[model samples]
Target: MAKRRREHLFIETDGQVYLVRDRGTLRFPRKGEELAFPTRAGGTMDFGDDVVRRLKPVLDHHPEEWYQRDALFDRDDVDGLVKRAIYNTMIRCVSEVVVSKGNRVLMVKATRGFSKGHWNLPGGFMDYGEGPEEGVLREAEEETGVRVVLDGPLNVYVSGFPGKPAYSLGFLFRGHATSEEFRPKADEIERVDWFTVDKALTLTRNPFAKWGLVDFFLQSPEARRALRVRRHGLWDGATRAVRPTVFLDRDGVINRGRKGYVRTPDAFEFLPGAIEGMRILQDAGWRLVLVTNQDMMGWKLVPDRQLHRIHEAMLATLRKEGVRLAEIYYCPHHVLSDCACRKPRPGMMLAAARDLGVDPRQAWMVGDKVLDLEFGRAFGCRVAWVGPKEWRDRFAKEAAEWHPDVVADGLLEAARAIAGRPEGPARGRGAGRGAGRARRRGTARS
Candidate 1:
């Protein structure tokens, strides 16, 4: 009988997925060769050639260390992108419990592990062939020397280390320790202590611990209800939840974006064919969401009440046209503010996904500026740009990294391109996924 190959974990970020073979070693699959990574179900998936091509430039600088242990996973940040793809090859499945005594929760200082020396909840890697319930009970006793009877799961947190090809899907449960005393394992834990929620806030270094504490203590009843819906398999994973939505930028794509802000209802003018274009998208079964940058409002150039009225009018106009927008979210900060929700930051898109049960990777973003295109790309969405000929031509030349999937003269043209296709992101307009001219904007009237 042959021994089965041990599974390893692979990580894909910003479209670059790489594999590390040994737990503590660094290894890269061959270039221009068909390769497979083990999946969680004991199957293998083809790691495509495109992944190899993107990795070559980095390999040239450290050819000898390509297969060295911890070569790629030890960095602070793998360039600018985080781990968006976490393959099950080397994933760790663990379970932790929040066993609180009075106002204090149980915490242990880890003597070793990925988060060694950091204060973490009582948990460890789930041994193969054991259920999560069995694993959590066993881990609690093994680490803290206190047997626990778990009640119900508080929440599940999926977290990954920066620049490491590993991730943990952890189940946090609320339980009570059988004994109030504890003896820390000499190898795995330094000490077990009870800390108040406020004190735990300062000591807990693990992201999952912090998240679990918030879910247990700080989350409102309404938020808890929302969390239940999210936890019930409406999402695929922690990173990308699959919801079909059309993320639209307000000023340019919906209305005629001008030099100054659209401050009043009178100034909120829809561009020609904008209403009909929205109707076409709605008919095609795409959820409409408005993601706009209203930096003028944050700067006090426009009052919040007036801005609310403007959005109300926009929504009312769409409803009159039989188009229902799922939601409207705007970033009210200056371009220089560097707020997370600003255009190009992807903060609002992520928040929308969490709030609306939408999947960004499977959605579309239609906008008119370079920032908008970048924002779509950041969230793994298909992008369509609506702009004048001169502006489109300039983007194609200078900002290819932010190249849009489709280019149109206005909202109507962009909508036609979107509706003309089946359900999918618009491929490059006659560009063949490389540098080429966008298809000339159609002249069809709305």
Candidate 2:
């Protein structure tokens, strides 16, 4: 209840009076309870005759989404209707991420050739069989030459530009200047200079991004703190150093595997985003590593040479896409075989982490199985589970036999969740559970 109380902010929603507060439900009935209006969307609520001049900017920031369901603003701007998604939505898209010393963030310039005319957190269109996370890293590096350390999510924003009719999501993450060495692609950036928050706001045209259109964004003195740029640097050995590691998983996380080990290249199926993901990591200067387990091979069900062939095929596929892989790791052992390389055991994860020269905890372990999380947890890596919640229910319960972490419907959702995407395109409803989950993790035995 303390997150918000009652406040009197007149809003124009079907005559519904909303007590717009700092960060909670904004719309309220005249004599009833206040309903959630939306935040980062705090712009339009203040657009009244009494304070027209005082809250014009806020009104302008009401966002185009509002018009999708409700009313419209009195005065219009070409940028109107095309606005940033709610701040919470932004968080959902790239909700949050980790930061380490010396990471590079792309400051893409708006060009006649590109989509916009201002700098956006660096990223490009999703590639065939590639997730957004990898695309962003690849785009950043292909545009800017610095190697990067992709830590975690930050925020997701939606905005519109002149002549553009659709909404584009912004996936921002915490990053740093990795090498202090950067060169922009031709016209990719008019001028590239590291600018802090204050400097960013000082930009000629604020790109009409989520922050520019809303009042709540820069309203609070504390809110404008960093100009919304990501954080950089972590102390180590009394000095700061660059840390870039592309975190990936084996099985569906990387090459291709489903329900069992894909020992032979013939069984390999690069699940959509595999190659592009690796490519993005490589261009971004992040050390690419595959943390995986090949248990079936131990049972004589899969072939080692086939595993190698699959990896070779994966690399070849990446090459065709103008992308490349950094490194590959896998555990060719079984759970009952008493070997430490199997998933749910940190042996493989630890080995991969050590090989990559990164703290297992700081690295990302993106996978489709419960043991994926187990290995990540065991080796001290941040875990990202990609799969339908229902598909994962039995597994989550099984994973209870080990630990808990983030879950999604494959690497794409994992990417959006990691990048902090607001809302995914509507999909089929989940059955049984109110949240539509078929099974939920309760507890498990080892």
Candidate 3:
């Protein structure tokens, strides 16, 4: 019988050994086979020991089945395998999607694994060689026996196992399921049910569910329409470019603004009626987009991972209130930077217009500051200012200089004006080309 090939690396300090070999089990070393390079003890394995140096050359010539216990480092062999080694360690792919229909979303109750009895979105890891859209569709079908069509990406979560070398890149998609009734897989899921936005929040323990459903889709009316627009096939992913858009500011408009930076999710609280305003705009054929300046990232006040968490929390909170943002665009540059995407610069707006296939000239920008108005003007968009009396007074001084096309007390009023609601004072307000400043002068006084 042939002996199984194995590789070994010895550590003398604590009398521990490391081994790597091919096995059917994909987990780390078994009880008898511990191969982790780093151990609990602060012991460093030195390959330059005299005994290892003597056996180095012989070990290099042999197949890579096992490292000689006393082998020294071999530069050429190690160099050749670096690319292959690194490739083996990196794992990036979409895992699943949360499918929504109006205020309700499909959630499967877990029957096995560590999530036993807990509810989560219907999805699993994408198959090898499959695109994200395809994988999500397949997983949705396999897990819940329901067909769903992809709308677009909601968010990309970058995560990893505590001790694993590979990373998990999860793409959360917003989709509409074709069938409401589904039979859960006997092993993976106990049952499937449609949970309302509020119910899902109370029942779901999964963070992604909180991030994707509770914070995003439930609040977005346009997204809800996209999920159910099968009658006309408008959401067949082809004719989305012509949709109208409403660009929103992050601070002051969607959430409370402060003199200091909102550096964490704890500091991020929604302004009253912010979600309702977005929902109103979305129902009126306007896709809600968040275009914000997060200079905190560039100034190193917050890291990207931390910001990612904050955005996730924000989305989760908004979703809880039944608001769905079409997309979010953030410029991480500091004020000192000349980057185009920063507020008062049209870079982010232009990028969003191109990416979302929306007409920038027809879009409306809602913000509380002069920079927001400047950004809208630069993008050829009509602007709405939602500010307190002090800020409005300040903006009034600039009415003759350059002002927003409309001024509203808050985001809900601004949304009402954009939606042409009868209750809105700005309904029937029109800002002709080169006449926006003049219109603002009259509106500012009123």
Provide the lDDT at 377 for model 3: 62
Model 1, poorest ten-residue lDDT window? Answer: 437-446
Of candidates 2 and 1, the better by lDDT: 1
Candidates arranged by TM-score, highest first: 1, 3, 2
Q: List ranges where model 1 is wrong by over 4 Å.
A: 1-243, 424-446
lDDT of each: 0.64, 0.45, 0.60
lDDT per residue, candidate 2, 1-446, as tens digits? 43433332233343222232324433322314343443222332221221110011224334433333123223243122112211111121211112122222234564644445765445555554666577667766766666666755444445433222224444545544477577766666554554332223223232222232122222223333322211011112132111334457766665555666565677777777656555544443444556566667667786777667677776777678886444565666666764445555444433332232343323567777776665555443456777656778767677665444457666655654544422211123221113212112221111
lDDT of 2 at 433: 16
TM-score for each of the candidates: 0.45, 0.39, 0.41
Instruction: Score candidate 3 by lDDT.
Output: 0.60
Which tens-of-lDDT digit does each residue in 1-446 have in candidate 3? 85543322222221112333344321113224543333332211222321110011122133444333223133233322222323434466755676876656788888887568888787766767888788888778877986788877776655554333456666788778887678667788888887654345445654445445523443366433333200111122432343457889989998898678888889988888888888888666576778888878788988877877777899888788777776777887788985656777665655554345544435788988787877776554568888777878877766434457678888988888888933222323332223322211111100
Model 2 misses residue 167 by how many Å?
Answer: 39
Relative to the true structure, candidate 2 has a C-alpha RMSD (angstroms) of: 20.6
Backbone clash total for model 2 is: 36
- On residues 1-446, what C-alpha lDDT tens digit does candidate 1 reach at each position? 85433322333333344554435533444333444432222123333311312221322232332332234445543421112222323557878888777656888898788768878778767897888789989988999897889988877656654333346776778888999778878898998998654345446645566556554543233322322111112222433223357888988788988788798899999989888888887776566778888878778899777788888887778878898876777777777874657777666665665555454434789998887887776665678988888878877754466657778998889888987765553433321222112211121110
Worst-scoring 10-residue span by lDDT in model 2: 49-58
